[model samples]
Target chain A: MDMVRNFHMAQGLGETSYAQNSPLQKEVIESVMDITLRSAMEACAAETVSIADLGCSSGRNTLSVVENVIRAVCERRREATQQLPEFMVFLNDLPSNDFNTLFSLVPEFVQKLKAEHDDGGGILVSVAGAPGNFYGRLFPSSSLHFITSFTSLHWLSQVPAGLLNNEESVNKGNIYMSPASPPLVATLYFERFQKDFNMFLRSRSQELVVGGKMVFSFIGRRSHDSHEKINECLLLEALEKSLSILVSQKLVTEEKLDSFNLPFYAPSTQELEDQVYREGSFTIDSMKQAHDWTIHEYAPKMLSNFSRAIIESFICHHFGEEIIEPLFETYTQLLCEKLVAREDIGWSKIIVVLCKSAAS
Target chain B: MDMVRNFHMAQGLGETSYAQNSPLQKEVIESVMDITLRSAMEACAAETVSIADLGCSSGRNTLSVVENVIRAVCERRREATQQLPEFMVFLNDLPSNDFNTLFSLVPEFVQKLKAEHDDGGGILVSVAGAPGNFYGRLFPSSSLHFITSFTSLHWLSQVPAGLLNNEESVNKGNIYMSPASPPLVATLYFERFQKDFNMFLRSRSQELVVGGKMVFSFIGRRSHDSHEKINECLLLEALEKSLSILVSQKLVTEEKLDSFNLPFYAPSTQELEDQVYREGSFTIDSMKQAHDWTIHEYAPKMLSNFSRAIIESFICHHFGEEIIEPLFETYTQLLCEKLVAREDIGWSKIIVVLCKSAAS
Candidate 1:
């Protein structure tokens, strides 16, 4: 989870150019954000409205997506000649995120917005900073008009506990994601995520009045089955390879290396759907399995860089700093190998837009 | 190429188990061997003969395959016992190959062969210690009846020259079989393999009687086009991953890692067929692609072991040995990432058995 946060931080700081360029990411974000903004406008019946980017990484793309959503909603509202509501924006990320870096570039963004609005003749627009963890409560009730979180939310706050026990019975030597890891590890992680996610929804449900809409984009597996080789085997294998190098070099002892596993898990679209559905606070407006190539083509460098940054600094904090270089070398090599091997085997960042409305 | 050799060598030690477990491999080899053997028997029409297993890794499986061929012929010979001559047998492999390992268990094999023979069981089975590469020249001309080499002949005597001329623009920076890598890398590797393979055929062509047949299996790709990702990308990715790890660890240094490339080219079945047809000396009676489960199921392990045994030990021997563990770790990690992300994506090892009819 920390790794994911760090990655998103780096991504927000213009590090995800690789991801933005990806047709898959671009298309899905555009489509879902489009639908989301439309729903927000319809539900609120506002000619213009405020939008919040929750866990907004430091990327121009995030704001760009919001800008497109705002424009989409405003354009539709103009047809009704409804008085335009003031447009306010808030960019939220972890307090530790590089918001300073993000803040530095905001002037230009505001200037561009003003320039466009001035040229079009009249619309009040406001943008603010909200740096905090999404897992805990952050916003005021009934404050947000619309919310967007692209390529976030799948991350847990931490790696699930006891996953790295690596006992002999557990076959820790190479048990990447055995069919028999007992769902305990996954269940624990999911439960925590559920708690956090439910809190996020409850918080958002309160902040969004009666019908504000929220849209999110995140990484997900194609299947819900944990034993699926691609889900468990591939990433673990890469990690194993990196560890092997560390062991071979005698930098990290074989024993220390054998007793570790990664913390994050990307659920499938169905799993995400079920969680949202069970929450029962938000009505599912739309969902989709985003095209993978879109993400790959856009974030080539960032994909590799973001992954390394998280692994080294956040995910496995126990890993010695000296091992970072070797770890990255191993990690990047594995990533490139995968990219070149299969065409359809790219990352999937899903988009889900929902409206917070009471059951009829 | 070295990887291929080591894999063959390891499986050679337990060929029976491998054949029994890997049905596709067994079927592929059997199909080709059967056709070639039948062609040889029909062409020979001789009452008696001597059969030899050349470059036959170390396994009773080779004898089993050969025994089937001899028995089928012997059954025909038994139909005319008055004109039958006793059959002689010889099994061969490299000096480095565990022949003693094979010798320890040969009694059972011989007894099985003798007991199976009908005519007073006078099948003179001889196990010879002819240990040399089949690439250059090994057997005496016109001295053998049947020749067989299962899963051999595709490997070049050594990593091809001109594959890693770093000075060349195309040869820069860890490119293996790159679309842009010096035309010579692929050409040289292919030329060397062709040269060595043709020599193998010529040696066998001369050594075998007018009706002699040779059965062999080696690695081959599913496509002739350079765009094929199987050979070009997957293998190169592994090499690159290894080098990247070495680079990160500062073991090989970036410059040296940049200049290294493995000396191997797994041709497509079509390409192999074309080569044999061009030789004209040996008619390709049958050709098939063998399933390599060991390569598929235990690829990371098998590939790592292969690199240690052949590649790391031979080619790129200049690279510091201290980084091997790190290098392999990077390689495996990259491979693992690719594997886990997908359900099933692997390679098809090709098996081809040809016949040399004095008439051809």
Candidate 2:
């Protein structure tokens, strides 16, 4: 997949936009807020604090997270009896992300920061948009003090390379690793994650100063087994079922359904830890897993909308825009049935806090 | 005028877009490229060179200027046998500017840079979008090494206060300074320029490191007389004439025309130098004036398009979008008659290079 061109959260503030349907991601952010605040306070000790929120898709959530970071830094500085540092917050996402909406919200964001901080016009905050893939270098070396990415890193750089063997689909009838897929499919996905995450770590290590901290929260599997039926995997399976129904109804071609695969993976906690240690530039500070029980309270329609917000671009790229409404309708029906059966519906998110190693 | 919300160049890739009608601006950039390159080479002496292009309205000209700076910095470092510095280029404009178009072009820009530089994986360049009014702070303190703003300082932070006295429009029948404007109108415009430009210098002084360089090119007058019939004033006179005709035809109200004034000023060389000295942070390095003779070579239709590209937003805000076609059509006719009469038709731009004072 051409991730840079084809991958982005649904843009704008429409009903199906990531901006509106991001409550699930917000819950994850809320769950990890304490860790994020602690890491920011510990990492920022300079006169100018540079923070970047990678994959900061357009929404109220993007700046809300940044505002919290700024507040935490100010509180820490005040307790230390130090002057407040100027802030340079770089909001990063794919070039295709809707930064117009993000930047439009900045003036209000700064105003709220000032009103709440009561810094006597001393808080200097400059918010800039850094549009690029985060698996590469996005900032200058040692320029950033704190970095945050929430529910974003599961997106691999590209669909695992070599999903086909000699032009024949190897992971047929499944868009991601599933029980029906061959073992090699899981291997390919895991390998791709390793490669992309390694590049992500190495690039950020160079960009962050020593002792700078990174806090990340993303969907992950509780089980060490690759084929575990995590909530993320279950959602994709439901989506696949919807696509199969479309194929059966002749609205989509069978070949198209067979050829598509998601550029995503929900890593096991052990897998994430192992990869971080292998990279060797960052020392693990803390890692915790939280299963969001809040999903049980959400209606199936809301879940479908949330799913569409995150993957609508990928779906539109591969299947065309015509399939969106009907496909999501079918997916919503599937979720409703699953809810009736009392099946699991919430995500297990792993939040990890890491500090840049001094020796690196 | 709400400069942040209402002022922006004509957006997108249409015939009337600033992107298409910016050849005149391109000529100015070309005229000052030597000064820009020299200032860039002299300023970027660190391992991580940070550069910002202020008021970088969306267009090819924006990145084209940045590319030249990068090339010059690399060449200088190569000559000195120093390691190439990683570049962090921030492209800044008002929040309303068309950053979507600007960012969409970044990948191709980076690809061309790498292809030409043959850096062997060494030349790291990160481009970010800074959306804010540059008259205020847009970066962290002492973080920038070089700043370039081309043809952008002409825009005041807002329209001069008190164009109305006791609810009476003082600058009637004119959108900007002109021979017909009252002397109080001239004072109001100059005072606004002094305040906005002083704020611009103070904010940038705090942002730029000591000894950092700034290269600016903007519309300026040659003669000290504010009412001199410079080409810029000539163009506005033609525009005012068109608007008067609109008022006569009932396409626009006389009250609306009287109330609307552009948030722009064309400072003379003396005015600009005096402001810089009074700001007391940046030392004047070099100042030169260049008359763009190319405006005479442009067709009247092209000139109309260029004018429309620049002020269409302001016109749309105050005079309504319905008047745009007729107003510019009338503007084109006036330009055609002026060309036939061999009248002055191009701008006189001032190119100033200033270095942040080490003592400051």
Query: Per-residue lDDT tens digits of candidate 2, residues A1-360?
Result: 588766888888899899999998888888788889988999999999999999999998879899999999999999988999999999999888888878888887887887877757668899999989998988888999999999899899998878977668899999988778888999999999999999999999999999999999998888989975555566787898999999999999988998899988889889999989999999999998888777678899999999999999999998999999999999999989887786666678899999999988
Q: Kindly report the interface RMSD of candidate 2, rounded to 1 decimal.
A: 0.7
**DockQ-based CAPRI category assigned to the predicted complex of candidate 2:** medium
- Give the poorly placed runs of model 1, Cα more than 4 Å off: A1-8, A11-28, A31-33, A119-121, A164-183, A231-240, A254-261, A294-303, B1-360
Q: Return the TM-score for chain B, candidate 1.
A: 0.76
Measured with C-alpha atoms, the lDDT of residue A291 in candidate 1 is: 46
TM-score of each model, paired residue for residue: 0.44, 0.98
lDDT of each: 0.58, 0.89
Show where candidate 2 strays beyond 4 Å: A118-121
Specify the highest-lDDT model's number. 2
